[model samples]
Target: METDYAIIGGGVVGLSVAWGLLRRGKSVTVLDGDDGSFRASRGNFGLVWVQSKGMNQPRYAEWSQQSAAIWAEFADELGDATGHPVPLEQKGGYDFHFSEETLQARIEDYETLKAKIGGNYPYEVLGHNALRKEEPHIGPKVVGAILHHQDGHANPLKLLTALAADVRRMGGQVIVGKIVIEVSKPDSFRITCADSTTYGANKVVLSAGLGASKLGPAMGFKAPIRPQRGQVLITEKLPKLINRPSLIARQVDEGGIQIGATNEEVGHDDRVTQPGLSGLAAEAISAYPALARAQLVRSWGALRILSPDGLPIYQESADMPGAYLVTCHSGITLAAAHARLLPDWLEGTGAAPDLEVFSETRFAVS
Candidate 1:
């Protein structure tokens, strides 16, 4: 099939970009891998978080804030299109700190970042008592929190399903079980899959999550991406115990407390371990004592696709001008920006956001 863009990877990142292209009246085709793929979209903490990001790079913080600002409108449109309400609560999110020293240190970092961003960073430090006033279930072990207004949580699975449905409704072809093995630009871009099915497009996007590491070099990208395993746990449905999400846990829209995410450098081994689950439970209980009574329902591990510097990469292949590489660790958080703003970058329009900092050249050796 011939299309304006052939997107490799049907995860949230790929689909969000495809959705944006289709909204611009472009013909698109999405080629996705089989069930064996290491899909982080399926197993994530689901936080549209902005705190503790871009601590070293202010531009990343600005980019995240832009995406978080548009998330509510984006979710509304997706819900309207697919009839699946992507439950999102963007009132704010907290970064709970058990020690006064750490909380104060983070505040200092935020102050520096705020100045760098021209005082646009919005956050407040709530002491233990003040935080308890908002979250009655907060335990005494929790000392304080920095609530960033742009942070929030959402039902990530629902968002993924809605995006897939809406992409199809917009007449975009989503081909599953097609593992793209080779991509070459011979006049028009040609993508050869394992099954010998060839697809042609004017432009190509390599957003295959962890799979990009293999395909990116051939397309003139130093994809420099790696897989870090994160294990998470979810409790059975119960009365709301968390009013806001933290790095430790959040009470999901369905009343289940989602406790997560131990960052382990286990290379692509996405297997939940006993120690990982135990550590998560201990931390959650320390944050909210009530979760100790909640029954555990599910535990899972997923790989997070990360660049060396832990920032999103947006670059067009130098050798092949029409091929683009888009990948990020926070796909859930950046879905809105990808769907609404990134199409301009891919099209090389004058309206493109200033994404020069995200290019792979930043990783070039001296």
Candidate 2:
């Protein structure tokens, strides 16, 4: 079948873009891989964060801020469309530091980034007493925290479900298990699938997450993307422990303490390592000594697609004028931008947000 835009991935990033395109009166199709595809949504920490982002590149921080600023409205629209209200909290999040020296150091870095980004970075350093007042369950080992006003968490499953349901309700096609094997554009783009199926579209978007590492180079994109494995631990539903999310942990809407995320450069191996889990548990217990007594319920690992610099790659193919590469490490944080703002850039409209900094040109070949 023919469409206006054929998206190569059906994950949150692709679905978010597809949802946006359909909202603008474009026909869209999402070609999703088989069940084994590494979906970042599965193990996301559900953080809609802004602090500590774009430490080197302020544009990224600006982009994230733009997305976070409009996220609640976006969620509301999706909820009204699909009747699945996404549970999100924007009451600010924390970056807990166990040592005073590290807390001061992080503040300095954030100060530099804040000045570079028009001095709009809103965050406050909370001393131990101030933090305890905010989170009564905080442990003694926790020294302080940086409470960035833009950071928060959400129920990722609900967000993904709402996005997919609303996309279909808007006449967008979400085709699962259609592994694209080849893509070539003679007149319109022709996509060959492993299931011996084919699809055609006027434009193509390579937002297939880790799958882009293989398909991007063929489409004239330097998709220098790699997988970083992150393991997460979930505790039994309990009384409120974490008042806000941090890189370390958060109390999920369902009352479970979600502790996570070891950044391991272990290639494509997404298996949970005992040592990784142990380290995470130790740090989490230190952050909230109460967590040491909570019973563990579930644990998992997911892969994060990262460019060399960890910024997003938003590049239109030079050879194929209508083909685009869209990838990022912070998919949940940027979902609003992908859905609400990015379509303007794709359409080359007057309202397109400037995304020149995220181009592949930033990566020089060795």
Candidate 3:
């Protein structure tokens, strides 16, 4: 049977869009790569965060807030449908600062961004004393923090499981282990897999993360995306220690202290290094001195998909009218928007979001 839409990637971004389209009564087939493909969705830090986003582009920040606002409803619906619990905490998150100078600098940036976005940014700078009152375990070295009320985190694996289950329950076909080879459209779109399997659809969505760099130009998209390596670490499950999630660390739903993510631009290399792990441990320990005694459990490295200016790229293919390219690094944060609001834009309804700012026109062509 011919599907209504053929999603080229089965990651969170692709699956979220698939779920949205299926809810709109559109048949979808998600073609996922094999085990060799770099799967960023599985290795992310699981933050539904808003801080440090769109510091340069307020529109991006507003979009993040929009997603965070509706995330609870999104999680609830998915949980009700699939019977999978999505552990989420959205009271607030932090930007922990070790020194007053850095804390003051970040506050200035936040204030400037707040004005640009018409003052909707809800955050307050807590001095060391105030922060200590809130987080009794906070290290004395931590000077202060910016508590952004909208920032939160969730269990990303549970989310992925729920979305996949719900999509299938809604009758969306999910084909895995098939590397898509080609996509061509004459009257309808034709997608071919490496095993010579073919699927037909009326439209197509290219959300294959870094794989878009290859498949995008074929569908008339300037999918100029890159991969930035982020090394992460996790400690053994401990009692409730971290009160809120931060860039430095967080206590995940599973009780593990998730520490992370050294941003290294070492092109396409996802292997962890001693130096990278050491640096992360040092910073994490400094942020919470108690972590120095925690036994190390696991360490990993994953590549984050990024655009030129680090904003999302949501553009309909100009050459292939029925084709769309949707990619972003903040897949976990934006999953709610992609699942709930993005379908309107894809279906060309009046309620479609104003996503022109996220289009590819902003990229510099070589």
Candidate 4:
């Protein structure tokens, strides 16, 4: 029973791609690991953000912009299919700055990136007074914010759920708890799981997130991926305090103020620490003083799948031409592009996106 495509990870990245391929009438099978696997999809900050991204690479920025452009329609379609609304708020989002120096520096970098994109970057710098007008609860400690018009957030859990349901609804097979242990190309691609179950497909997509580091080399991928821990915290449902989502926090549709994400290089340990949660709490409080009184509801830590350059890696195996590797840190941000546009590239339709810059060849020794 060979399928058209066998996806090796059922996380956001893999499910998004599977959803796209299924829409094109392709036969697909999603092989997911057990509950014990470290899953970033379920533990993300839920931001469909674009600001502060691709500072060093404008192409990546443009790609993110492209995804943001089509996100609304994508969400709508997923909702319609799954009957589960993927709550999305794209009114705008912010990058709050506590000091003038960091704000100025980031604006300078954005200016350079904006120029590279022929001025496609749409952002506005708001002073304390102006920001206060937008966010009345904003604390005095926060100096300003950069509101990027294309930035926003969504219910990441809902997005994942809708995608999974839609994939199955569209006749795609989803096999859970199938931790793939080996991938070999004898004739067609054979993906062997730990339970001795085997599946065959015409092509393979390795989107196993952090697990790619282990499976990539066997399939001719550099797979130079590492894990970076990000600790996050959430507050009890409260009145609307945040008008827009930011790296610091956002008021979720369900009423909780989702504060997050301290970037730490603490290896693969996704455990919340006192210092990490404390730092996040202090920062959130600094941005919104009202949060000091908000009841802390939950705290968690998740590992971000990061490439060496922190950009997405989209490459085909040199030894096994039909095998492809697709992984990125911005799975939520790029979900639209993955589901709406990436299938063309995977099918080699000639209308495929020019993703050569993201190829593994970039990491080759000079």
Question: TM-scores for all candidates?
Answer: 0.99, 0.99, 0.98, 0.99
Q: Model 1 reaches what TM-score against the true structure?
A: 0.99
Q: Determine the C-alpha RMSD for candidate 1 after optimal superposition of all C-alphas.
A: 0.7
Per-model clash counts, in order, read 0, 0, 0, 0
Per-residue accuracy of model 2 over 1-366 as CA lDDT, tens digit each:
699999999888999999999999999999998888888976789999998999999999999999999999999999999999998899999999989999999999999999998899999999999999999988898999999999988889999999999999999999999888899999999999998999999999999999998899889999999999999999999987778899999999999999999998999899998999999999999888888899999999999999999999999999888999999988899999999999999999999999999999999676
lDDT (10s digit) by residue, model 3, range 227-281: 9999999999999899999989999998999998899899989999999999999
Which regions of candidate 3 deviate over 4 angstroms?
364-366
lDDT of each: 0.94, 0.93, 0.94, 0.94
Q: Tally clashing residue pairs in candidate 3.
A: 0
For model 4, how does the per-residue alpha-carbon lDDT over 1-366 read when each residue is reduced to its tens digit? 999999999999999999999999999999999999999999999998889888888889989999999999999999988899999999889999989999999899999999999999999999999999999999999999999999999999999999999999999999999999999999999999999999999999999998999999999999999999999899999987788999999999999998889889989899999999999999999999899999998899999999989999999999999999999999999999999889999999977887888999889998
Worst 10 residues of 2 by lDDT: 34-43
Candidate 2 deviant stretches above 4 angstroms: none
**Least accurate 10 contiguous residues by lDDT in model 4:** 350-359
Residue 101 of model 1, lDDT score: 95
